[model samples]
Target: MTKNCIYSIPESFLALLTVFISSCLFAQQNNSDPKIQNQFWKNVQFGGGIGLGFGSGFTDISLAPSAIYNFNEYLALGAGVQYKYLKQRDFYASHLYGGSAIGLFNPIPEIQLSAELEQLRVNVNLEGSNTNSQDYWNTGLFIGAGYRSGSATIGGRYNVLTDKNNIYGSAFMPFIRVYF
Candidate 1:
């Protein structure tokens, strides 16, 4: 009678294990249903910046277009292209064109933080009697934070790497970002 009791206990345990395994498989199948999956293109956002300035002997015009892929509500990665034209009277004229990659995070709905790596190819031509031209590359790493609105962010970013040859005159710059 003790042997029969031991054999019956194993059978009971096996039945319970089978039921548990079946339930788990059913849940997994429901989660993997194609109707519930997220599409890739739905996660993309596009935005950029534009600037124009004119002075006595200086004129600056710039255009930058960018796109980002948001993995969720909090994190995004993006890239952009930039083109800028500048002319300073009796000093120099230059054309800058390049691209940048950026990563962004939002801890709360009202604040956004970012890190960006930018590279620009610069071509400078001396004005006045000398018509010498020089070409080089300028790179910058920027870290920044900003206040967020509906689809726009207003913030300031500081270049972690800036020197005499850096494109932007200041290490700190205020920015406005808009995306849709």
Candidate 2:
């Protein structure tokens, strides 16, 4: 019985080690395969969105240019600039910095959701005593979704100044995103 006990102890330890090693191998296999890894540099991406704005007695559209640095299989950081033009009312522009992350929820990927915020300079063509000049600052929120493969996104946003100058509205934009 003593000999049997010693022999079983080694066998049990060997079994545990085998399980540990195999589990690690399984984990590696479960991650995206070589093809996915190669495509990862498609990781870094750049894109832009355009939107139309209404209200405040203006007909306006906005152009947003953006850049992203993807850091991993599921996370990225980005910054964007928006230029808004009113046919004859006001001009508004802003620069935004933010981060993003994506999750593959299904094998047939089709959609993604993202959120963002922007530190903003709310500028407009204010009729000055002499000339029109911008005179406001604010922060705002942006939220939206993307349909994979289409390089298109639709989003809505709003902005308000800490001092009560409000530029609140929504926009619709189609985007073209290219990954490198």
Candidate 3:
């Protein structure tokens, strides 16, 4: 509330900022990674295009793009985002949110596993009048098993969990997944 107080506050604020800036500059100048510059791309991958899945409230295919990481020949992991068509006996093609998680084979063999979760909200107009709409959220889970070779992966997953908005059923979504 006074001129002296305002002046005192800025002095300490600037001093703290100066120390933080100097510390970051010092840290950057002293770091070293032998392969950081040349081998950076080996740790990343990409997957894309049409995909398929089947489960509760979902029995059709979809399109997806994914990214992956390779830790070693026996261990790998990945994540992906997808735009999916949820197949309900009563509904047509709709928008859904989906993601993928993968676990690679161990012991140097041709086998792998994965888990995926997909969710979406659908709105319906009562009396089909297009005035006010009713919204419902549907989610499904897929736990898969399969094989991997370098950049491609194929697997099948069962429904580990499903939150239904209407009539509920139980099934496994046997799906083929590709990792990049």
Looking at model 1, residue 26 earns an lDDT score of 95
Which residue pairs clash within candidate 2? none
Candidate lDDT (C-alpha), each: 0.93, 0.55, 0.63
Model 2, span 46-149: residue lDDT tens:
77667787776656676777776666534556777766655443343333223333222212345545556665565554443335555555565544456656
User: Largest lDDT belongs to which candidate?
Assistant: 1
| lDDT score for residue 151 of model 1 | 84
**Model 1 Cα RMSD, 1 decimal:** 10.1
- Cα RMSD, each candidate: 10.1, 11.4, 7.0
In terms of lDDT, the poorest run of 10 residues in model 2 is 98-107
TM-score of 3: 0.59
Clashes of each: 0, 0, 4
TM-score of each: 0.76, 0.46, 0.59
Candidate 1 TM-score over all chains jointly: 0.76
Error of 1 at 115 (Å): 0.4
